[model samples]
Target: MPLENVHGDPIFTKINKVKKQYEYLTEDIETDVAIVGGGVTGAILGYYFSKANIHAVILEKERIAHGSTSITTSLLQYELDSNARELEEYTTLDNVITSYKLGLKALDEIEQFIKEYGNKCKYEKKDTLLYTSKEYEVKEMKEEYEIRKNAGIDVKYISEENNPFSLDLKAGVYGVNAGAQLDPYEYTHQLLDVSCNMGLKVYENTEVMEIAYGKDEVEIITSFGYKVKAKKVIIATGYNTQRFTKRNFGMKTVTYNIATKPVKSFDGWFNKILIRDNCDPYNYFRTTDDNRIIAGGEDVDFYTNIENEKLAKEKYSILLNRIKNMFPNIKDIEVDYEYCGGFISSQDNLGYIGEDPNHKNLWFCLGYGANGILFAILGGMMLSKLYKNEIDENLKLFKVDRFDK
Candidate 1:
């Protein structure tokens, strides 16, 4: 597939200027670990490995944080895009509980990093609210609310008066110990910057063209005609994994996001709650600590003519209209930034993290399911353990071979 698409505004322009220090595979160099893709997941993996005093090198096809990670609206909340009730059917009881709890653990890791590293990014522990306008769905959501509560997940349901939108909430689910978000680009850059300072190496515009695995080391060939060797290779590329490996574990879907101009004096319907509508293809909204309303969706895809800009123009119009309808006062504001990208999600919505069982020393941390941030953090911890030949019990649910059938 060709690189670069006509989606997403230029949000990560800084990474483009970071300069590539290590160039080409003229003479093979060895490292304890090689992490591919500089998105959030790969960056986190690099940071964790460097902390272990292991020599880790990260190779990116393009600039750091310039992929789907930057395109995300940065909803770091634990309220999953996957319906909790729906998940119980596809996965085992143990897996479901582990999956639900993992979000908070990831949150804790991020909070600790910010504290230890100093108040760097816009990290804030926030509350996420999923609500429906329709009364019937509200009734159904109450059942889901109970499912989480019964599992000791600390969730609650919102009655009509409790919601900010005048449109009565039929149902609402709340998760408290769930999340934190900063500017995706800034957050990613900080991790990478600090990681580099700690002796971890990051190379930009250095895409891995091919991989040939060996008994002890893996040979990575890049498009720019260079090769590097690493004891363990971590495939940190998201959505692009299908292009390079077995495609059984993940599938791709398109999603959209929009960042409106900073609002001056707007009265929002809700106070610091992320809201999700029960509409067909769901719509979710959150507020930045600075007061700008950032919103996006569980995107819906359609036929597109690459030459025509009709779809983009129409999508922007639709998004703006929805924001106006929900918060009547925010109509005149400018939609200065917006983004759209393809997200590679798993069937059960949990990311694939750990060493490839068949190929020793070949590890991957593919972001799947609902929470990419949560999965990315989870991926780092799991990979560090797997690198030391420690089996992470949670990894069984994400076995790439299990879906071979």
Candidate 2:
């Protein structure tokens, strides 16, 4: 599916500082691995593969980081869309805890990368605030808080009196050193730039139309009648993976996002921390380095409608109201940008990683959740290790066949 219209005018892409370019694939090439997307996921996989001394290439249908990556609000957190307390129903408490830890590790991995390569993505480490205003939902908030606290995570439960924000909160969790924000477009470009220097080839405007699996290698046919043969292939095509596999591993949803113009005053905001609520289909908000308030959350089923502007306007209006409801002090909050994007969510609310059970030399790194970028980092590290014959048992937690068990 084409994502040109799917990801609307996101604010990050509008002020992107990094302006790197790449040539499109004009001839057939061979590599140890071929990544089928150029978003942050594929860029991440490319970086890891290069570090592992594997010859890899990234094939992007459009310009790099021009897809859903550009539209990402990039509130990087260790927490998933479903809290640990809710996730334990589908898996073990141990597994849920492990997943949360893995997410934290992924954030560290990103930090390490920035340290080594310089912070070109405006990345910053911040605390995350997960709270609910409704007095009745305080019990569930405390349940989530206890689960993380028991797991040895650095978290504090804040009551109405202790809440830092001006808004009255029944209860909330302030997660320390557990959240971050970044410019996804810039990060993707930076990773790709570093990886390309380390033997990673990238091609833009190269669309893979078909795939042929062989005993030892996989061949991907391009839109312009070119072909790429590789020992393995990683599909990081986001919500469009249904085009290649018939398995119903995830469902798609349409999410609306809006960014406010840079503001002068941020009174009552706690360290400008990432904020989300306990409400269903929750609204999440964070600030950009430029002091623009970026928030999103109204979601609808994507399969029912491809792209609708009238509906998008309605959702945007709802999101704007949500922002005001959360922080009424931010006066004259003029919206600078509004967008819509498609994201996939899994049955267990965890990422799908590792190789497909049915296809040899075919792997998938579908990070389907609110924490997609963090899961992508974990997927890259695990998959690169898998390709190096250093298999980690944790892969079982994110295996594609986990639902079958």
lDDT of each: 0.72, 0.87
- The residue pairs that clash in candidate 2, if any, are none
Error of 1 at 38 (Å): 1.1
TM-score, predicted candidate 2 vs. hidden true structure: 0.97
lDDT of 1 at 141: 86
Best by lDDT: 2
TM-score of each: 0.90, 0.97
Q: In model 1, state the lDDT of residue 133.
A: 76
What are the per-residue Cα lDDT tens digits for candidate 1 across 1-405?
313432757333322354233443344567889998988888899888888778899888776777877677667766566676666667775576677787778888998899889765677777777777786676668876887788788776787776655544667787775566677667777888788888888887787888888999898887767778888899888777754677566655556666677787566665566667767567777777666767676454422432235565666667777777877755556676766666655667777876676787777787775588788888888778777778778878767665566
Runs of candidate 2 with Cα error greater than 4 angstroms are 1-7
* Candidate maximizing TM-score: 2
Q: By how many angstroms RMSD does model 1 differ from the true structure?
A: 2.9
RMSD value for candidate 2: 1.5
For model 1, what is the alpha-carbon lDDT of residue 197?
88
Q: Which stretches of candidate 1 lie over 4 Å from their true place?
A: 1-6, 10-27, 302-308
